[model samples]
Target: MNERAPATSPEVLAAGYARCAQVTREHGTTYYWGARLLPEQSRRHVHAVYTLARLADDIVDLAGPDPGPATAAALDAFEASFWDAVDTGTSPDPVMAAVATTVRECGIDDECFTRFFGAMRTDLTRRTYDTWGDLLGYMDGSAAVIGEMMLPVLRPGTDAVAPARALGLAFQLTNFLRDVGEDLDRGRVYLPQEDLRRFGADPHARVVTPEWRALMAFEIERNRRLYREADDGIPALPGASRRCVATARVLYARILERIEAADYDVFASRARVPTVRKAALAARMVTSREPMRLVHRDRAALDPLGGTWVSDDPVVLLDDTGSPVGQAPKSAIHHDDTPLHLAFSCYVLDPAGRLLVTTRAASKPSFPGVVTNTVCGHPRPGEDLAEAVRRRARSELGVEVHDLRLVLPGFRYRAEMNGLVEHELCPVFVGWADGDAVAPDPAEVDDVQWVPWEEFRDDVLAGRRTVSPWATEQVPLLAGLGPDPRAWPAGARDALPPAAALGPAAEAA
Candidate 1:
């Protein structure tokens, strides 16, 4: 068990809440919007739970190149610290303190939190479910745990657990359906294997066919059944909380409808419920006076497995902060090592020759306060430079280019990122826009804006523009290429040195 001092001060709790609100507002509007609907007194509690979950989820999903080991270690330490805080009745971390308060206030058991952590840990290993039962089990631990925790806050002394679990499965299934292509591209497939097999489909197999469509339809129908089952528990909830749950259900269910509208072609494109549709769903909730129906279809499914798999051995917390309890005592079993690795970045320039930059979202691992190029991402396993660049440009910028000129090939660069050795053999490409307006992906590019090329170049050279070291190195090289409309291989150029090494006389056109 990790040992840490408890946070009892009001200032620390307030600061923690503020940080939670700020980070959640930037990365997850869905959660932030839901929190806003809660009563003022309950908002902090909800935000605390969201912040902890968000941080844990990002530790696995957004830790950047090779996050596996680090993410697992971080989660382990977080869980240890969380339990220690609960025992001591105080936490040095503000977020943990708020969570502790919420747990106590709402009578939230350790099972829910432990189950949530268990689900997150699955991200380190489980990428696909062998059966629909397996996928529902995953949802029961992940999304359903959240609903179970909220039930106490929303409607105490009520057996709304079964409905919450069903709703959670429905919500997660809808999310999986909508993000099929995106998840598949990330080396993840959330669709159940049993349904895929039943439809003579393999999610991992190359090329999606009519069989895949039938499989998707069957899965969607399963989600609809769960959605109906979950809706029964809503009326049992408090009147104020009922509307929010209804809205969330309607909003998520509409995503499934959108996927159906697209003819279940999730392999080719993603599905989304537009804002207008969301508004319509909310309106329907308000206008319709349908009484909440309570169903007791799957009581056993709702019951959490008995007993925890707790190891008697104590786990140490690696705080890394400069304090007595911060550093974990070095052990003979394992030692940390730093190794050199590669990274990827992009420079988004519009047809007007203006460079697009975005402020890093708070959820990102590096330079969250800093601004960087418009479209940037790390290469996935088995992906080459050109494919990685093209995929990232399309995914992040939401724009495809048919003519991408490889301006600089095989240019190696080295830099230290967050105390880790970063190495890359970058292949810079110049993509010309073809009257397609910019539609930056909010998940990657937080706030996008175009800066004039000459001004951007000057800023880079003059040290006025705060950009990534790699981007700082590539910007001037790209600017020198000018607005030449040439295809790739025809525009290959010699590699350039670091931006600082370039003299002022050479930088000025």
Candidate 2:
């Protein structure tokens, strides 16, 4: 719902909105890219919301390490002044004028602002968070409230309070993870102290030790869970609003990817999505209805296949520790927010060490017709992943034999193809075919080739042969294992995902 413009003059509101847009662009490019997909009216409201939050943050932070008496007083005054504008429905301050207009037009709840300011005030006194819960208490105001504030502007078809708040928390957590080093320098550490002790990680050292990596990996998993929770609210949003949120969510989550690529090193430099990519994503969201034509879930376009709490071919659900919590059917598991599950990928090689490349059947539902590794399939609940690899190899490609060893035991990725996601903790295995003969399954692999493993790896690295997203990442790491796949060092059974229980078939490894 929208209301008539506040009595604020058109020239004044436009200038205020223009300033707000600049602030969003300068400080929050991901947000700007997402809002670019919104209609002009909603976009303006987003700018106003961001403007108020950003300026308030500036009031709290611009004083740097020495936020003396004036800083708290200034923050309180800014908060009071914003409310005054909201109360009068007008303001002499240009940005405040636009922001107040948005508050009136969008019917944003005043309580959100109450929590938000309260959190900002807490920041002035509180420096370290003792546990995840403690940090969440502060984020409830500093971050999650931002989502509630945006709900009125988003105008979801259904009430999306929980997911929106989760999305806000996810975004802020991502920020905390990416800015850990910066925060530490500022006499604050957003990471939970309990988690630090549990992992035996000392962020104060600012080194990428194994313990630090473990801690970061755990935190990243928790962050992704929030993103998954937020995905439920996406379908409830319509048109450009949905596009806006989806683009922003995708872009923001990518920062975690960058952090990983940098070996979870936040101290060296800020990990970020290049501005060019953000613009390209924004353009794609604006131009194409499906964006990537990979993960389409537009409610008006297609009704999703209904899922149940229970599953027939169950996928072992995992907690943040990568341990199974329960199960959901393979058929019912995947959607926009596919849960991370246990899966295995097998890269088959012929006697000559030539890699077996397979093209997925064109008629398949997800990632149809994509060329990828020899076999990729999920482990049945309680089934061994090594056995799953062998089963998929025989069933999908009709070839497999010796050297069944895990190569990338920690291989995990999130990818979308043909409207479904393959979010899995997929351990990769390398095996050699016993014989040269092959029979590709018409239902799974319609075509197959035996490319020299070196040539395939080089082509993948050089962008000559575009395969699956997993393949794109796997090639480089596999190359580092050895020049020849036949001689690569074998991975031990202890490295498999916690849910992938070892069975007799896996004992062969």
Candidate 3:
């Protein structure tokens, strides 16, 4: 079973995601590689869900001599814990915690889990499916719900659900054909008994006779029909999701080609899609869909503030402890009476240790034309603060900065100018870029300066240069870190006092 390291820190969640990623990459190569196309948020949730399902499947299929009531009891206990986690927004079990978080964040219904476990419980008692309808009935929970659970994470349009189920069934039916011999060895036959009798393919014989080949050919065609039914739903998904599902759909469909290549001899050996083939197909899908993604990138893209942050996009509302409680529209924030919310500030430095500073565009907003750090941004709903900063760096400064370290985790301040307010729990980050010359986006930045760290600090401290109120407060602290941004310690965020509690400093500014 995949295990999560205990802790609720950001580092711990990052570590948990990594562990789940390992399970995905090592155990489900085709699915994992396909998942690589998703955005980070969607990809991690998919990994968590896959890890959960794999754990449950292991209990049902690999319990060996304990595959009776004992296995059933363990599964029941697991389901109970899953529900508990769902209700509480957390779980002591690492895998469940991740799954529960995804379910909560994505708004997936709990009914999907109930239906899935119902099918898993049936695995202990059911042996042979009597007809196609019976096989499909079992597959509904065992297979279709897998696709239903993924709907929220995929964010495909609602009309795609039925097709998603069909696609899932197609994949599961292909697996049944491939695993016929293995299932028979376990005293079960996943193939419907009516199909076996119709094709004269006896489950007891376990041989690749003419009747078996004919039967396999028929079942392969049946699965192919389901794939075609699923093809219609691909357009309903977002670009990255479309690419991901397309890759998985195409790769799984190739299993039929492999089976055919072996003359339908699934019983002799398991027919598998080669790793090389999977890679080639995925590459083709990615390249083919690349242009479409670029066309749609701007509308869904994160702004320089590290969020959609348009006039209508949601800004995360923060509680006293800096935990998110709710959200308000971006246009509704930044007034004289603005509420305390989560925000971020980033400082970008070049390899030569020169700091990149910018003056905000004089587009007539609050603090317009004020000189500040490289760029400051706010987190979008459900976005990680660090990730948002990197996005803002790229979108605003047109510079790629790496290894950003949070320098002030408890940073907060409230300043009012005219009728505009700047009240934020803004964490600070320091990042290193490749060169001193950064291409600034004219819409957000009016002027850019790359100044020696010591010179900039001296000017700010000597009161020889005017800057934003927040910048005035931060420059002194940044100067204490010495010249090289890369040489900054990992515990930098601990060096500063809580920004919100600095009442005197705010008053002076």
Q: Which candidate should be chosen as best, given TM-score against the real structure? A: 2
Q: Each prediction's Cα RMSD?
A: 24.6, 12.9, 24.5
| Cα lDDT tens digits for candidate 1, 1-509 | 22335446878777777877887667554555545555766767667777778888777776543457777899899888778767675688877877776676666888899899999888778778887668778887788888787777676336888888878777777778777766766667887776577679876664567887767766775666677667667777665577657666666666776777877777667676565655555555555555232122222122111212111112122212211121121111011121222234555466776666677554443344457665554444334444666677676677665444455554455654432233444545555556547677655556767787678778887899888777788876765666332322333233422111112211111
TM-score of model number 1? 0.52
TM-score of each model, in listed order: 0.52, 0.60, 0.55
Q: State the lDDT of candidate 2 residue by residue for 1-509, as single tens digits.
A: 22434678899989999999999999988999999999999999998999899999878766775577799999988998898888887789999999998888889988899999999888677778898789999999999999999999999999999999999999999999999888776677889898899789999999999999988877886777677678878888887998899888888988988999999999999999999998887787787765424123322113233222122467788775578888987754675457788877888888787888999887665577899988888788778777777777777777766667677887888997534678888888888887678898887777999899889998999999999999888889899998977777766667767777755454223
Candidate 3 is scored at a TM of 0.55
Q: Which digits, one per residue and each the tens of the lDDT, describe model 3 over residues 1-509? A: 12233234565567667878898988777678779889999999989888888888888888752378889999999888888777776676666777777778777877888889999888888888999889999999988888888888899865789888988898899889888888877777998898789779985787779888878876776676577667767788888998898778777877877888998877789888888887877777778845234222322111212222223557778777776678887554654346788777888888777889899887635577799889887777776666777778888888887767766666778885543578888877787888875788877888999987777888999999888888888888776766666665544433333322221111111
* Ten contiguous residues with the weakest lDDT in model 3: 500-509
How many clashes show up per model? 4, 0, 2
In angstroms, the error of model 1 at 320 is 54
Residue 405's lDDT within candidate 3 is 75
Candidate 2 TM-score versus the reference: 0.60
Tell me the deviation in Å of residue 206 in model 3.
1.8
- Candidate with best lDDT: 2
Off by over 4 Å in 1: 1-7, 23-28, 63-67, 205-208, 267-269, 276-509
Model 2, residue 164: what's the lDDT?
98
